[model samples]
Target: MSERLSSRSLPVEWAPKVDPRELSIGIVHLGLGAFHRAHQAVFTEHAAAITGESRWGISGVSQRSASVREQLAPQDGLYSVLTRGLDSPSVQVIGSMREVLTAPEDPAAVVARIADPAVTLVTLTVTEKGYRAVAGGGLDLADPEIQADLAGRPPRTVVGQLAAGLVRRAETGAGPLTILSCDNLVANGPFLRRLMEDYAAALVSVPEARVEAVSSRQRLAEQLESTRFPAGMVDRIVPATTDADREEAARLLGVRDEALVVAEPFIQWVIEDDFAGARPAWERAGAVLTDDVAPWEQAKLRMLNATHSMLAYLGGLRGYETIAEAVRDAELAELAGELMTRDVVPTLTPPDGLDLTAYGASVLERFANPALKHRTAQVAMDGSVKLPVRLLGTVRDRLEAGAEPRVASLAVAGWMVYVAAGRDVNGRELPLDDPQAARLREAAASAGPGPAGLVDAMLSIESVFDKELAADKLFRSLLIEGVGSLQSH
Candidate 1:
């Protein structure tokens, strides 16, 4: 056993700016994962340090498992964020988290934390699937867990847990709160608010006999109305932490840290300045609080996220394991630039005074940072959920403008080929980590071994492509050609 990370053992040079003992839990964060630790918690700590506020400490809840709690509790929620730059690595001890709880072990404890009047803000990074969104942007009420949640059973999903907690808060008069979404989804704030509201309504609209014995429908509605859901955009390439990363942290601090997180030395957070109550002075900590986040959101989604997906599929097919290796390839690098300049840029109305060109270049540079080993497989996960927002929008806009979405078409084709083969070009097994993986594989297998048939079958997925695009002759031809090109390579 090694020494644990705590205030007593913290090195002098890496000490937290604000004394951890003075901080109080004022924020409740869901999905206690690497991204949250590297992004939001870091910002919150800075916000408190800048404002001399000791009330912004966070109580983190792991939605699915107890692993995070087990790692951080013994250390008193102290973790090191290793920023991997091109030249050298820098480490910072994050002290924003004051408590850790796992939903599976004690959901009531998580709910109780949320109901605490001192915790005025709630933030989430539960990803796309956690929202349980359907095609038309509504809750997937048909999902088994969602159905059980609506019927007032103990909540199992993120949205379900949120609904249950907020309802409890309402009944207990815990006051108004703000909910901020830090996910990659387009218009994430409003999207999450709708999902939560819909879930609450479903709970109340249940048959009278099935309604839970807690609060009335009207009370829940009133409490929800008081809650605020602010949309925000967060950008950082924080990879899943490996055992090697933990060992490195232990070497640096002379103490073992199981909750270590590794990230590239770049971070950007743009949030809509819409909050119901007090918030951290994150602006002082390098966050941009704007009245309108749409332009920035669109820019990041189209340029950065879409290009990332392209690299994951196309680069993975070319036998690259990591993003750094993939982006260094001349052909793939040029293709990424083309995708942004030609197809993606046209679809974006970037925020005023923003340079889309420079942003695109910087994104490529970040992808090529050799210090960060971001796996292509990690970025490629949940393709079925990510494609419509990241790439398809560009394709749709370019088609409407009478211009060919050549690169976007190729990206779609790359995804199709990847899903069909289920293995990289190097003969490595590629895990299809997607909700629609089974359906996609069956479709590909049924279409026979030819690229043309596979292209037709993939394009026909109604959940992924709009009916018009699926049936478009030009789109179909371009996709077929793209698929054939991949097969030849």
Candidate 2:
């Protein structure tokens, strides 16, 4: 414990007193990180506070990062959440997490808990690259980890872990459990299900005799469709933690917390209603529940994430650190504003009663938050993994509708320049995180000849830009312009 600095009358735990151990772990969250704490945990806490149902409390699971557990579990699964605005910050202690399970510590136990009947739902916030989808809703069978988990006869990756758990739940006659995917990936629920099912099917893809034995034991593999998968759209500008954030969190919480998460004041979760058995009062907690989340997904993918990629690539090349820092540049900021309001929003139909202009304004404001130190390097990671859906998909959609793709073309140019970077405008080494970085770098080094060969090869990867798009006259013309910009800049 440390000295208490605040004289405010509020208790250290401002949230209502509710023993989470008394409640079963109805929700198991994967990739327990800052976003989960600031978004889903806060929502769950509010739901629990109002409904007094602790069963919705979360059992957080982490395989790679045990540091979050180190910070959160010490306070008896308690941690402070700060929502930052322009002037002041609002603080609250979230207590909806019942326990933090380190899967690496006890994989079997994690599997068993997921199999438990009391856990009715599983939510995942694993980053987009973690999905390991090859392309077009199919599994990346080439992934060594996925292959290992299939061979090892237990779960290794998140999808594999989840499939094993689901099988266990089915064997014991546990009722249907909803698998809610809260990541920004398009059609997240169906995408997750396909990945999971692919992993499960790979288990029995061996010889006939071996396949028969495995199938007999893991009969629940075929019953995956019965398990609900709800697509969702989550919005918040929670930046990566820095030394300053760590120190500030320790000062406020009266103890050092490595897993402390700082976020902006705004948050939104719009989910498609598809719970199997029971769920928390998400609607009561201000979540927008609808029969269809597609329109909302489209808007977010095109407007928010699309613009984010633009800032990320361009900002990195220009040596900007955070989104706020980049947006502070008048030229870049205006470009982003125009992209959202003009090219992107035209294609999207905002949900009923939701104002697109107001939403766009709010998004810009959030992007300019000085408090959130979201790094360009962080956002710039896995670009080879993100380009197709985040940029080209939207561009293709617009082209199919016979609309102009000026902003989209600009973003694509930014990516090309970003990938070819040896140094930023500040002479800082640009850390490009793409599978084809080396190839791109080599191609860029030999830019004496036409760069079209490099562009053609990159576009042919099937994972990023599709073959059909590569053949389009307008698309190729845009790429030519984009490539010219890259060489000049």
Name the runs in model 1 displaced over 4 angstroms: 211-215
Position 466, candidate 1: lDDT: 78
User: TM-scores, in order shown?
Assistant: 0.96, 0.92
Error of 2 at 180 (Å): 0.4
> Residues 450-484, candidate 2, lDDT per residue (tens digit)?
55654665565566666788788787677767667
Writing each residue's lDDT as its tens digit, candidate 1 over 1-489 gives 578887777778878878888999999999888999999999999989989999999999898888998888887788999888897687889888899988878877887888898989999998877788887578988899888767766676888777777777887888888999999988998898888878766765677455452354566677888888888999999988888787778888888888899999899999999888888999999999998889999999999999999999998888788889999999999999999999999888889878999999999999999878888899899999999989988888998999999999999999998898888878998778998888888888888567779988887788888788888887888899999999888
Prediction-by-prediction clash tally: 0, 0
Candidate 1 local Cα displacement, residue 75, angstroms: 0.9
Clashes of 2: 0
